[model samples]
Target: TICGLFGFELDNFERAEVQKATRRLLEHEKRFLERGLRNFLIYKDMFLKSVYRAGLPEILIYLPIIESGCSPRARSRAGAVGLWQLMPSTAYDYHLRIDYWVDERKDPVKSTEAALKYLKRLFGYYGNWELALAAYNAGPANINRAIAMGKTRDYWILRKRGVLSRETSWYIPRFYAIVRIAENPAEFDLNIENAGKKFTFQVLELEKSLSIRELCRRAGIPYSEIRFLNPELRRAITPPGRRYNLKIPAGSLAPFLSAYHGIKKEYIEDVAVYTVRSGDTIGEIAERFGTSPSLIKLINGLRGSLIYAGQELVIPVKEGGLINKVPIRNNFRNYSSLISSSIRYTIRRGDTLWDIAKRYRIEMEVLLALNGIGYNEVLMPGNEILIPVNPLLSP
Candidate 1:
């Protein structure tokens, strides 16, 4: 009867197993499970509507309960992320942008749409709801292999044969239990509250890069509220070189637009650039700049932590109007004397005085003074410059 009501029928044995699991879940993890269920209730209307629009079953909304505990920021040990727990590769395959700046996986609307498309494709491949669900948990390749090895396409048969992981084995039953409980929470002594107001927002396309803090300050929006809406942004600031779709509270778009225009360009600071040194790493650079590795990766558009010597990276400094402060090693007298022993050096692509000084073990001040260059002077490739190399050091 429960299966028929849900538009999917399970045998009596399967029903008994599902009920047993549901009872166990309710007994031990009720409070913990209720928190996730409550979160789902907040967005239930949005989720169900989206799923129905995608021509998927409304019950699909319950998938996130098990996948992410209804948390948008959920990330798995296997690198799955967001409400639907999408793996990076899977997200990318589905055209969900997973850059350092905006991981669309964290966006509920975007991730849910992507998840639906993925689910539809899995259903098409398996041609069975249960098999599709299994494929979704363990991947189609794993399920295909299991089907081949077990000589059966039945999800339960494959599970019984131990061809599927224990987690995959229970995934469907857990999903079913959640669906049943959600259909009638009152039966389980659960009290679900209506999401007071539907989560609503307006997207403001940013013309230029700005920090979230500055955006909130200018628009008079709460920092926590703005951040909560755009959890995908890895850094405090929106990334440069593209129009970022910034989500703002509903009814605040007009104020935000007016204030954003009034804000001076200088008030929106540029990210500091740091050229990598021989012994530099993303972690070390982050430490030096008082930022995070994720922020560095985001600003620099790096997918990984591999950085080579002389690579320029954008440093994610939270504070504005801050200069890059490289430590001056030598005294003024020693620095002045050190400039006397100079060698003619040609600037390469992306070369800076900071990098040159670090490379030659000379003070940056001495390098600037020796070359008659200003601190803000742009260095061009093939430009000849004098480097004050130490007598004991080789260039």
Candidate 2:
């Protein structure tokens, strides 16, 4: 066999689907292929290492090329994200966090592990890589229904009988075409000199909140460097109240640690340090910070709202400090004012995304795009979501 995928041998290059995808990649999608190929070279080692550790084939590294054009930050309209295109629900099920703080779906290493576990599970259940891969595109339930309707476990049969959706039917062949070309790039005149190089980084345990910009200034590196390594940071800052694993640029540990030690204890970004003035109140402070009094108290560890004048308080500045200065919920103004800038909204009882969209008078599609979610995506109570104040903005 000239090509083998998962456990299936493929000597049938004459198949219309596989050959057609190959030509399209070579011609119409050539530019797209070139871009994805370049990105694949950069992250090749990172993707392949996880595949290897999971005991999967090296060819599986090409899956991301098919899924997201090898971009870690790529996201589908359906809200699937990262190299593996994991949905929010699936990411949550696999212990990946997607929130106002971070979306771990964009984390290369972590998402790879979670995705590989899922693929392994699918393969194990179906006992056929083709079926598993088909299920990966269309959900398992769809694949199951396809199998039952077609009266066969074979993906090609289901695809041939139109039991599989158009997208799912093409997904496998596109994947195969990509793998065949990638397995021997030289044959296609593709040059990837550092394709085998690994993505190396030194992990720094951050105990307090720090913005990417401040960290970059301290580490003497570009903000893009740290951001490139940590795509999960939603606000470009590590959250407080937990220790975060921050991946710094490879070989920058010495300088980063040196600058980090001299920083003040309470110094953090996305927050304002205020000295309580005479006649000051928690409600006043909260309003000024675009946050709730409860959040301010919780953050400062205040049991009751008893405070003396001249006491320093850390007030989270939401709007530009960076996630959006979300006004305390009840005091929200008219939709025009509220939707003019980014704001964080906590889902209240009996609230649906559509209802919120109606309240804001924003299109449901626009609202979903702003949050990088689908119309059908779940909105749980107490979960904070970002809302775009500007009508022209898209996620």
Candidate 3:
């Protein structure tokens, strides 16, 4: 209400722009409106108790409409993300860590707290609720300058001055229209559950830094569900440090904590170099390395798989070398001199001997020859294999 009232102080143009934006939202985002309302209802108690305290439910409902339309894993073009749409810098200011392993902006509960803090601060800065809402939509700095230049605190006056962009000017009205529809979903053609459901969680305290894979193993929980619970963990692994709270399904906490330490941590290696050539694709390279294109993309910081001829790309590999490098063997006495060394590796899941050989830039026959593996021998996990360390191959 305060945020909306602030809109009254805007210039005629600003007010009209807000109205136009409101019309656009009412027309374009009908489904999103329903979803936002549903989520608010679902998280009603938690939203009210943890964040809003005494704020109007409509204000709480307005968040997802402005954020990600209630998409839990929504990522913006600017990289501001999650249900609350927090930017990285702002997430950090609110103590939401973004690191190799985790990004708390994607964590709904954590991000809600951060978003509320930001909203509250904005409200405090602009006493007029409409101005606060406008500031939230555009930014306080922009609104402040607009008010100063117009010599009027009216949002419509500022809008007439053309200080805010079309989208931002209308953002508040859109928010208001959405609130109107959200308050009474049945009035529209939309027919679905408006009442929110309850979500329960059990706090998981880590005794040691463990990968999500291992956590799932010990807990008898699926990785999909684990990801749902701990979206903050970016990679499958949780980084080492002080124990942080991990939310899990309501019932599994006790059993999970009991065997959490017993599951052996299997760390993946992610370092490799691949030569560019005539026909190389990110998907192909990823398949060859037994990883996903997204992982490769992330590790290499690739914009869009645009590569040039003869370019060298760094690839991720299993952490430890599977095959041990062979030591130097004696040179031939008859000829001038030739020496070689080789490495050994154990077969791992999803690994082919050919793939392994190509990874180290060695011929398939050479790999088979060095390891004394039979042509018919099936590669089994943990089977010892040898790898030649010499870059050159004998003719």
Candidate 4:
């Protein structure tokens, strides 16, 4: 394989390991891998330009392929986010905004720039691409400690010494494997399609915060399209009281500006702040506000359905009896039969019925009906409850 003959030579053990990892990735996630490659191709120009401008090698473009499969919204279990998989602290260090209204780590262009800057620093510290790549996965301190203990800066040596975490140990090889296969898809018998047009957008500076749905309406585009263009925006509304750069479809800026100015001032204030009280859950608050729990979490930066007392959340409310315009699919109606074939969920510490309902993406009313529990029922740890099995809901 080209990977074994490339910039970093692989020993027999390493070659076999790389081949095994490549095979596993190809066999188990071929479609997803192909989609990732397609996504990479879509942003190839952006990646190349960003890397070249940073004075980094073009191969660095493949980093996001391994980090996030080219998905801007990718988030890891450890709270690392975006295509570059930057943790919150690293993102903050890079000056990427992470707040209630937006998480800039999920912005494709901004995060790519931030990641390139960070990678350059890592490379300068290590003086070797392999070591720098390893440090990118594990912290620099960990890599430095490993180099000190192993008395060598070679990443392979550290891997052999078992000085890196299992994930970090495989990171370099996996990256190499992805690069090799991507560089020579035919050699690996893989078929990757073009991702059509390159992603292009124009930034419109907004004087006041506007509901994303309203922006979409004025732009004559679907809400989903605007959301796709601006993945960094976490809420239905943009943050208030500041000039925010809003990305819209190319050439639609003039139309958007004209339509935006025509909107009524009252409709712009569509969001309401609600302070969470004791026994409050995201689902209950969402229900009260005529919004969805998922939207609340997105707006407030809540990772899961968990909400604590005294936490203030931004909730989108209906305007003039018009339904909340965020176009989330109406899946609540499907919950009645969905819960008929259910599974047991053990109540954990601080568990609430609303938490369980939100986690499973079911209506709280349906959850109450399933377990014959009341709306205000108090839940205790270790109590087993019936939870609906919905494939559409994320576990």
Candidate 5:
């Protein structure tokens, strides 16, 4: 049924699995489908152009709809980001920049380009769209192992042989279902034309550092508008000491240029020092500081998701811009003075995570996250547990 659909056909489109997935979307998850389609239609033009320029299939644009609900800033807990939901490693592999001031994974244009390139590569590797879709959800390494184990190149055959992960086995069918519904929305009791007007924006190139708050003030634009237009900026401020490109609302160039020239030049604002507290997570700290976990990690030179108590972090802030959800204590240590120290505590018989967390004045979840333990973890005696010990932290 997908014949002459999108310049490629890797499987039968009318499979019962695909039909069940479609029914699941239309009957059980219609709200999400509607919302996701609304966002997809908003960026339809931009997404189409990207697909065309990359010489990819038109149906490819729907991938982001399924991946991120077409939200430019959507991120997974595993650190995949943007409309395409690219993991940091994959983003880096595609030459998408992920740094302190900006994460290109959140940039609509850059991330789309990177995602299309990745998809093309995967498609080329498998020579089948269904397999490529499966590989995208579960990495190619997993797919390769599945192929070798099953002695098959066909995705469905490998799926039938139970050589593919349950997630991957279901992924392609769900994708096919989305594509089918998108092709003929009327059959699904949905309408694509209702997605609304085009999302419009203009890019401005700047030579000096500037905070988004100041820019919005000068240009007479709403802070939320600017943030929506430029979701890739990790902080309110632009990259220091570099020529940066920022996006603003469409047709606001005249006012922005006039206002920009009149406003006094400014530099990056001073950073606020924060001492990581007991039970602190990078995500919680980022939410408190009006920044992102990616930004916090970049600033602190942290390579992983874990942050221990007593670690000093430099919070990127504009004047009084941080969200005050927490009564955060300021350690005031310079970024250069950032330090993290920890001690090992050997688990004793009858020791529990909750008891140990209470003794250390940290949360039980923090202990589990720190040690990568499961919620129902059974402590083994003599096993050493990593307990964060910061000198500045209260006993």
Candidate 6:
């Protein structure tokens, strides 16, 4: 019996169905499924523990597989992010902050905690796996109204109302398929391994802000690995506004902590900011900020006022902060006149590196190198990463 965080029981046929659907989807995606199995296996333990505590159905485990294929940097078209595909509002309501420097909704551990907490509450209300699952897709209010209007508790009946998106309608079935396959993968062509292996990590309390590049330099870990481990850091640098509990590979923590103590907090870099140009409208400014005009207006004290030339407007950006002043090298010079800078995108529930690369029209390898990740690294939501200049593909 699956236990929800709030201590409820999930023993309904809904669990079985969701499992079956998830398995089918996994089979279908076998072509795209390659590598990262080790990380997925490690994450599975986290998933099971949370689900067991929440009294959620085991079938719900498959939700992440569909939502992000266990990728931490996964994002969705609807702006949902992370393994649980949480929207910014939902993540915020659950105490996941999305800011210029970090978005915790993409952090695998953080997102899983939020998602399990939400699932538990949904189960508390309905005591049915299918209904709770529906609520997970469409908010609880939507499911409650459907229950009241249809005069039935059947998920399929509500699914036929044509109100739910096609994805939502099929979502439940997919969940079931995955659960079914996970239960007995050997029966299928799937060969499961590393089911019980533990992922080793140690926590470091951060006081000063630092970039992943610097951390990588100190920890002797690949920059990409640090990015994968802390996707919630929207910038390559962590900001002073928030205290971060950085996780490092188990044995590396001692060395990292020792080196971190020697490094002064003030030595940490700040994220770079871009000033608005003359005749630049909010739309252009938004593009420059890599955010919407509304967000820009909200950030800067602008009442949609006309922007003037030489106005030094602070650009609201995410990811690494300003670069520390480096001694000018005689060979190096700034020649490009284009407005080029980096944007930090918080990994959300449904984001993938490939999707991110495609969205920015950047080569996959270049993006991976920029963020310090390998080809098969996980992109958890709530993690912050730097996006280098690619204005030609900017939207």
Supply the TM-score for candidate 1.
0.67
lDDT (tens digit, per residue) of candidate 2 on 186-213: 8888655654544679998888765556
- The residue-by-residue lDDT of candidate 1 on 77-112, one tens digit each, is 444678898865566567666543466788888899
Deviating ranges (above 4 Å) for candidate 3:
1-23, 53-58, 194-197, 265-395
lDDT of 5 by residue, 23-62 (tens): 8889987887887888888788898899889888888888
lDDT of 1: 0.71
- List TM-scores for all candidates, in order: 0.67, 0.71, 0.61, 0.68, 0.69, 0.62
Q: How many residue pairs in model 2 have overlapping backbones? A: 7
* Two-way TM-score contest, 3 vs 6, winner: 6
Best by TM-score: 2
Error of 1 at 275 (Å): 5.5
Better of 3 and 6 by lDDT: 6
C-alpha RMSD values across all candidates:
16.0, 11.0, 16.8, 12.4, 10.7, 13.2
Candidate 4 lDDT, 28-140, residue by residue in tens: 87887887888888677888889888888777898899888888887664446788988655765676766445678888899999999999999888887889888898889
lDDT over C-alpha atoms for residue 22 of model 1: 90
Candidate 6 lDDT trough over 10 residues, lowest sum: 330-339
lDDT of 5: 0.72
The C-alpha stretches of model 5 lying farther than 4 A from their native spots are: 1-7, 191-195, 268-395
Deviation (Å) of 347 in candidate 3: 42
lDDT of 5 at 320: 54
